[model samples]
Target: MATVQFKGIVKKFGDNLVLNGVDVDIKDHEFVVIVGPSGCGKTTLLRMLAGLEEITDGEILIDNLLVNELHPSKREIAMVFQDYALYPHMTVEENMNFALRLRKMDKAEIASRVAEASNVLQLNKFLKRMPKQLSGGQRQRVAIGRAIVRKPKVFLFDEPLSNLDAKLREEMRVEIAKLYQRLNATIIYVTHDQVEAMTLAGRIVIMNHGIVQQVGSPIEVYRKPCNLFVAGFIGSPTMNFMTGKLALEGEALFFKNEDIKLSIPPYLLSDAKKHDGREVVLGVRPDDVLVERDGEKCSDKVQGVLEVCELLGHRENLYLKVGGMRVLATVEAFFNRSPGSAVTLCFNYKNMHVFDKATESRISE
Candidate 1:
């Protein structure tokens, strides 16, 4: 186990800058996930840490030791690549022990390490199997096994499950979680999938355009996003955003847009009068959009026409049109409402978010 640190990390490819002044501290035995969209430099950062990419300016410290100029083989870190970089001709056992063999380790010691990793990954039966003979999930497990045999201070996974089907990915996620518990090793995972970040990470590092957006537990990021991008990126089904302006009317602050108007709760923004006539964006999740049902009315409910209903087993998604704006609401299965039906919906203020339009930063508590 080891603590990893990136201090003022920067990378450049000739005239193009990929990462700029990125800083993150990963604690010993922590499962930290770096996640963002494509071309965000998440993988590039990981490669820098692994010595696969050069650092234009900055320091990488592993276990409190400066490793900026250290060779990748001396970093004491094993990386599981996105494509499951296994030797095509080598058997699983051969691939797992290749590093040890390169070091000219004792035969008995190499065999013991291989056996231990095989048992941990349940790959004993596939030890003699070649990479092409195994399934996608099995090959990924072998790649991980190769890393495990090294007993490195840190484990880096670069989207190791992206090549698998959804069902296999789910199963591998559980396997990796269990492996973490058994090893209690420092793990850094990189992926573009927010679901993977939210479910597997002890702490998530959200990055965009080479800048770190937020670092916190999944619940912390989900419940209280720092800005508009964090608010929109970390959740499922995406959050619905309504752009408008805030106007102080008699003591209450109201948000007015072309499609609808909503009163901002005092607790959400205490100094309401100070933000009078300010452009802002209101954010609400699909699950937080309350729809009128069972003859019950919602506070500040606005009328809309249901445009579509998508049934997703245990839940249903309602697409509604209010004026010219579109809104999505996730509700219990069998909403029993057909398209074109008139529906009234309101936001759950407890989970509402308000952002300053100019800075794209959250303004509400």
Candidate 2:
């Protein structure tokens, strides 16, 4: 296991800056994930660390050694790419031992490494089978086994599960997590999937347009996003946003839009006071929008016409039109309602988020 560090790393294609002054320190034996949408430079950062791409400015260190100029083989890292990248003519055993052969490792030692990795990956039964004969998930396991045999100081996974089906991806996620625990290896994974990052990473580095938006645990990023981008990007079904302005009424602050009004919770008074009368964006997660039961009384309630109801097992996503803005709520699967039906929802203001309109940053506690 090894620590990885990126010091003011920058990448540029001609005049197009891809990564800008990025700095991060990954601890030894830590499973850190860099995740974002495509073209966000997550892969570029990973490639730079792998020595596959050059750093236009700044340095990369592995285990306290500056490796900006080090060859890929000298970086003591193994990368598992999106494609399985297995040789067609080679069997699983051959594929696993190829790197060891290239390094002129002893035959017995190579066999020992292959046996152990095969056992760990449950690929022993398919050792004699060629890549062409293996299923996608099996082939992926073989690819992982190849990396495991190397016993590199750091493991770099670049969307390794992207090719697998949804079910296979979920299974592979658990398998990879177990692999990390078994080996206690320092791993840096890159993916565009936030779900993968949230589940696998000890710390997630959220990036967008070549800039890091936030870096923290999944719960930290989800519960307290630093800006509007993160709050909108990290959650499923996306968070709902309403444009409004703060208004003062006695000691209470109210958020007012055209025909919608929601009282700001007292806990956020200190933060809301600074932006009094200024336009702001009110954010609430789908789960936080409670579907009011019949005759239930709530102080912060809004009525909307149900537009769509997607019945997902255990939970349903209800799309509604509140005033002129669209809102989504995750409710019990049993809560059935047809389109055009009027529904009342309670806004859990205690869990609500308020963002400054000008800067698109969170202003509420």
Candidate 3:
């Protein structure tokens, strides 16, 4: 397996700048997931690496060697697309071994390689099945098995599971993770699903508007987002942003917006202290809010009326209207809660996320 790097990569489609000076490095043998909303250039980046798209400007390095001009087949990489792209007339084993046969590899060598790949993807039982005869997950596995048979130095997955049903997508995600472990190959997977990015990636690269927003581990990026785009993009329920003004009340700092005035947790005050009286954005995740009478460690409390309540078995999501702002809070699944009741809630000081009102960048020490 080889490490991959993109330096100052840029792409444009007839004046629409798609990738803007993007730079990223994928460690050897690492499973890196690139996530962004549609048309954020995530797939464009992958296509550039695969030599499928011509990058307008930049360097692409595989194993520290410049490969911007390298042909797709010469780059020592295999790509699996969202579509299975299987041969309708060929059996699973034939599809898996087609590339080798084209390269004129010995028949015995091709058979051994195909058998090994089938075992890795658990497709041994489906070797005789044609594309139309197998299920979606099985066909996807066959796609992966074909890639593995080639022993490519790097693997690229372009939303390969998008074609599967939700349940099958989740199952295939685990299967893909296991395949990565068995092969130990560098992988670049592009997906819009945050759940897949969070679960499969060793590192998550979040992009927006053709620019890279942030790159960090799933937890790090989730807890400490680089900018407003990332804070809003990477999580399931999405972090809540309240427009507010940063103010100094005596020796302490607080952000007051609309009817809510929240103190900047002391530990985080260091960054906002100098900019007292300036405006800033307050961010908090739904999971960080606690129900009434929940704790004593909360920094502030709000009295809100639940406008909508959803029971999720493991937890309940309460959508409340605190003045003009709509706040979503998650409570224990067993907690008895209903709409129209007024409830007091608190949030931990350490859980608050603050951003610069002007630049929208996170105010982190």
Candidate 4:
């Protein structure tokens, strides 16, 4: 496994620019996932590294050697695509060994590689099965197996699990995670699925508007997002954001909207001191909000009427109208609250995030 590095990479289409001066270094044997909403240049970045799409300008390095002039095959990298791009006529063994055969490896050598890869992927029972005879997950494994047989220095996966059924997608996700460790190969994965990015990556590169937003471990990004796009994008149910004004109520630093007022935690107060009376975006995660009965008193509470309740088996999600905006919060499903009831909502100020209203960048130091 080798490290992949991109220095000052740039990509353009006609008059429009897709990637701008992007510089990232992927360490050896690291499973780095690049994720973003559709058309945010995640695929473009991966394709550039895979030599599928040429960069308009930049340098790409593999194992500390320049590879910008190298062909995809010469780069010694393998790619697995979303479609499971397997040959319909080739048996599973044939599919996995084809690349080696192209290199003029001996027939017995081919069988040895096919056997080992098949065992790793549990594909022996279906070795003779053609692409049509295998399930979607099996086909995906075959695609990966083909790459595995190459013993490539780097592995690239482009939404490889997107076509599988949900259950199958989950199962394949586990397989990919295990395979990464077993191979100990450097991998760069591209996906729009946050769950996949969060679970599979050693570090995640969150992209937006053709720019890299943040690169950090899943928990780091979840706990301390750098900007509004990342803060809102990384969490499920999304972070509840409301426009508010920062103020000082005596010594207390407060974020105040017409209906929602939350005091900034002491840890965050010093950093927010300069933004007093300025409009700020208040961000809080769904799980951090606690619903209380009408008469409860809490440090930072809001009064809102329940507008909708969704029972998601394990949890309850509520939509409430606070001032002109709606807030979504999750609680244990058995809370037994009916819609249209006036309820007091409590939020952990320490867990709150504050962002600049104009820049959409986090202001909570």
- Give the top-scoring candidate (TM-score): 1
Which residue runs does candidate 3 get wrong by more than 4 Å?
none
Ranking by TM-score: 1, 3, 2, 4
* lDDT of model 1, residue 153: 98
Clashing pairs in 1: none
- lDDT of each prediction vs. the true structure? 0.93, 0.90, 0.88, 0.87
RMSD of each: 1.6, 1.9, 1.3, 2.1
- What's the lDDT for residue 72 in model 2? 95
Q: Where is model 3 poorest over a 10-residue stretch in terms of lDDT?
A: 264-273
The lDDT leader among the candidates is 1
State model 2's lDDT: 0.90
Which candidate would rank higher by TM-score, 2 or 3?
3
- Kindly list the per-residue Cα lDDT of model 3 for residues 183-245, writing each as its tens digit: 888999999999999999999999888898999999999989988889898786877788888
Count of backbone clashes, every candidate in sequence: 0, 0, 0, 0
Off by over 4 Å in 2: 269-271, 293-299
Scanning candidate 4 in windows of ten residues, the lowest lDDT window is 293-302
What's the alpha carbon RMSD for model 2?
1.9
Q: What is candidate 1's lDDT per residue for 1-365, written digit by digit as tens?
A: 89999999999999888898899999999999999998889999999999999899999999999999999999999999999989998999999999999999999999999999999999999999999999999999999999999999999999998999999999999999999999999999999999999999999999999989999999999999999999999999999999999999999999999989888888888998799999999999999898884222233878999999999999999998999999999999999988999998888888889999999999999
Q: How does residue 204 of candidate 4 score in lDDT?
A: 95
TM-scores across all candidates?
Answer: 0.98, 0.96, 0.97, 0.95
Model 4, global lDDT? 0.87
